[model samples]
Target: MDSEFENQCLEQEENEEYEETESSSVQEKNNDGETTKQLSPREVNTIFNSETEVCEYYRQYGLQNGSGIMIRNTRKIDGVNTYLTVACHRYGEPNQKVVDSLKPKPVVKTNCKARVCAKRMDEDNKWHVTQFDNKHDHDLSPSKAHRFRCNRKLTKHAKRSLNLYDEAGIPMNKSYNALVVEHGGHKNMPFSKKDCENYMREIRKLRLAKGDAVALQNYFNKAQSIDSHFYYSIDLDDENRIKNLFWADARCRATYKEFGDVVAFDTTYLTNKYDMPFAPFVGVNHHGQSILLGCGLVSNEDTITFVWLFRTWLTCMFGNPPNAIITDQDRAMQNAIEQVFPKARHRWCLWHIMKKIPEKLKGYKEYDSIKFQLQNVVYDSIDIDTFEIGWSSMISKFNLENNDWLNGLYEGRHRWIPCFVKDCFWAGMSTTQRSESMNAFFDGYVNAKTSLREFVEKYDNALKDKVEKEVNADTRSLSTTIPCVTPHAMEKQFQENYTNDKFKEFQKEIVNVKYCECMMLQSDEAIFNYQVEEIQYVGDSQTLRTVKYNVVFIKDMELEYEVKCECRLFEFRGIICRHIIKVLLFKQNVFTISSKYILKRWRKNVKRCHSRTKVTYSTWKDTEEKRMYEMVCDAFYRIVDLAAENLERCNHLVGTFKKLELEWDTNDKGCSTSIVTKPEYFVKILMVNVA
Candidate 1:
């Protein structure tokens, strides 16, 4: 029997009887052309009993048998395009020879009961079950399958690989003692070699990073040293701090020699760290340039502090007292100046004095009234008694109460020179304004966060820059010369035709000449309106013609000369422009200042304190020197109160408070002490002018 016949016999015997329906039955033809119908129950049973016959049946049927069918769940296969019927057979050639040539292929059968070879493929694509055949788990009972293999040579080796607790051996990780010794109490580590290797690599990388940081820090330190070295040069011992005062003193001595001292003093704050608060003191000479005399890192701001600072500065810079010390009328500063330099003529800045008038009278309702009264006090050319009467009248008109601040401020009335109240010779030199500008410049070098060393360095650099600028400017001014003789010399050289005598007399009678301190001639753009009657020789009419000349001075020394009769000298040569030459010669006998030259306005003579039984550096013995630096905690505590008192006084300030009221006329000078124009007008004018 063939394999198909045997399989049919087996099915018949198992089912007892089988009937083939039209849909279920299939027919096959033998190679000899014999046809066969569906098998009977007994025939199917017979086919299952004999394998060899069934193999022979496949040979006759021309179909491959006993070859495993490769069944793929079509839906499970990737990219399947159509659905499959589960019971249908797939198309392929079936031959017994082909089946016999096929070899058994190993298959992995999961969750099988047998332990030896796991599984294999037979004639059908079904699993031939086997069991786990691993000999590593030899300790397990033959009937049971619960045991699992611990795949390591020893307990210690297993612990090293898996980081697990082993009952049979010591742990492979570092011992507690070893860890403590190596890591200095940092004991965290995994047991496995792989984890340890990774941890060690990370530690090495961190160490390298730290080394790189250290190298960069060293390089930065070297670079900083190189940068600071450029501005630094060691000369005299610690003399950089004192250089400004030294240069200023030398310049002052050179310029003014025996001239009276006119020192204007001012002080302003410098912000820095608490340990080094620099207080800069600025002094100005007659020429209006500021001299930085001394600075202090004071812990407090008070009378004593000011005294110390002033004494140190004056002693170092002048070696004696200044002839005059002008400052704002601060009571503490006043007292300090009087006590220290008793001989110096102390004058108050007039701007500060007038700024106090509005400060004392707050009850004034109308700004125009305050302004008109104040203007009379400042601008009117009146005697001192008349000014006092006008001031009293203002007090009554304003209905303001007793104003002690003003009285106290202007107590020594003579000391307050009202330079700006009315235009004076020294119109611009009333206040320590230039000193205030210097103060602003000094503030740029120090801020609240600046360190002590940075403050000193900035101070030195600023002083150096200021000194260089002034020296260069002075050198430039010295190199320039004035053309004093150009006009006058020309008239002399022209002689007879120009009528040197007439020209000389004409210069003396008609022209005005002025000279600058720097010996420069002054000429301004001007226009003159005049008609010449006649120019006739009084002594000799035979030699001279009766010519009339009308001359007018125009912009930039240009002159227009019209002669009644044609005079080629005045017309073609434009000789009128050289009229100054005739004037210079006429004054050859009498000294005449240049037109551009004006005498420097007088500075109030400052007094120098005499070195009476002098106090020298050696005089300060050890005890006194120590006392000078003794910690004054009390002074620092009082500074807060002092500052608060000043603010409180300013709060009730009549002048400042009155200015704040909107009803106060903005244009009134006394009502508005702040020197600012109305913004609306300023902007409108600016726009119109610019357009």
Candidate 2:
């Protein structure tokens, strides 16, 4: 019996040693592994089938450990979520509005090794956590995890407000603060700042300016829906990425008809994330305000891209090419303009032409004087022969014969010199270029990191402000008191016929009338020529430079007169020159100058002068009465178009309307003392009586 008991003890000792060795080896193999057994009966009954259900299971599982875990990666087969990897993250927690991408992800070096991957089985329509590595190197914190993990997901209302502010150009930080205040603070908020950032990125993507291709498609669709007259054309390369894009709004198209005669094209500034040069076709309005005619985005200012853009602009403006176009001295622009607008006088931007003078010539002696001389040669040169003589003499005097830059500039003189292109109408933009002002104007609208979507939106706002300014100027010109003018019929005619701003300009010339004198140089049956000279003396201080002008005039139908001047001020500035005004006064027409001499652009009736007035109403909210007033004005516009005929016909209609106005006033005056009724009743009764 004693021998059998000792043998049993030895057998039990051997079994214990074998069991301990097997357990240690099993643990050593599972550094990051979880249970390999089938789930318990309770867990098996709680198995998930769909992606939503499986995701819910992971959420619950994560919560049980006092930490929130999110889906770190997801995969699908045949467009169904068939697999997913989840992990616990510390920073992924949101005060509110956390994005899935911003959810904290686990790293290999971290103690939190919590992870679960689920896959759908083909044999059974069931989902299983095929791989779950639930081992951790650190302790889990529930309270801290609760701060990130949502007790409840974001509601639909909150999401709507989020998207609303996102589109309104509100910053994420401000939005988050507002949301935190509304949601009862960070501890109780549903998402974190990281979550909001992710949402913003998604918003950017939706605008189609982000990295997503699908989002770009959505942007075009939405833009068109908002502005039906909004037109956009895109050219893409083999990679299916945009190479060129052009767009124009209804207001731009309408403004172009009158102001598009001379356009300044500039594309030097980069105001987008894609580093694309933003090109704006800009023009000056009758109000002397800079107006946007159209805009484009191009990967490069190459000939090919420029060709597409110019063609697109023509298409937008109904193929009516501009009479004169100005742009910086970019070779690509030169090539494109020659092809697209073969007839349009292509002039190099004057600002860029002069900008290089300081950089290239400032190092020379008498830099300031040299710059002054150069500008005079460019701007003040009156005749081609005079410009040539001054240019040759200045070059020789400055010893710029060896300067390659001057040589290059001389070669391109026709493009930048005013005298060379004096015949071309530049619309008061001779001394101005598109670069300095364009860069300044766009700097307020966009920055280097602006996205494509943001740029498009900001452009409309900028354009809106410009148009509003123009409208206000027009209103002020028409409604405000007119400035007093000299009693001369010529000056008085100008004061009533021209806008207030233009009157100020004419006033300058009229004031200088006394500072000048004219004499008849020659006369003929067909024409009369005169020499006009300006003289100024300051009490023996210094005699100012004597300026002279040669003006020719002819009479047509007894009273009809025509004139041209050597100064070419009217040719370039789009206004009658002081020389021409001097000739008219010298010719003794003192009654009134021909209506043909008055430019319609400078006239107070420019808008009224044009018959068509189709208004593209803005989308801002307005009161009912204001909306009704706009609609009534719109109806009046239709009536004007219908009655668009000779001036006599329009005057006849106006006379008949005045008779009706008199009858209505007579009735209103008779009723003012007889009626004591509700305001609406009186309004209705008066209309009924008048009708």
Score every model by TM-score: 0.34, 0.64
Location of the lowest summed lDDT over 10 successive residues in candidate 1: 143-152
Query: Total clashing residue pairs per candidate?
Result: 35, 14
Query: What number of backbone clashes does candidate 2 have, counting pairs of residues 3 or more apart or in separate chains?
Result: 14
Please, what is the whole-model Cα lDDT of each candidate in the order they appear? Answer: 0.38, 0.70
| Candidate 1 wrongly placed segments (more than 4 Å) | 1-260, 269-279, 285-287, 353-363, 379-383, 419-428, 481-691
Instruction: Give the per-residue lDDT digits (tens) of candidate 1, residues 26-139.
Output: 575744588866431122112222232332332222111111111222332255322221110122323334333468443222221211111213354332222212112111
Write down the lDDT that model 1 would get.
0.38
Q: Candidate 2, residue 324: CA error in Å? A: 1.4
**Could you tell me the lDDT of residue 560 within candidate 2?**
71
Query: Which candidate ranks first by TM-score, i.e. highest?
Result: 2
Query: How high is the lDDT of residue 130 in model 1?
Result: 27
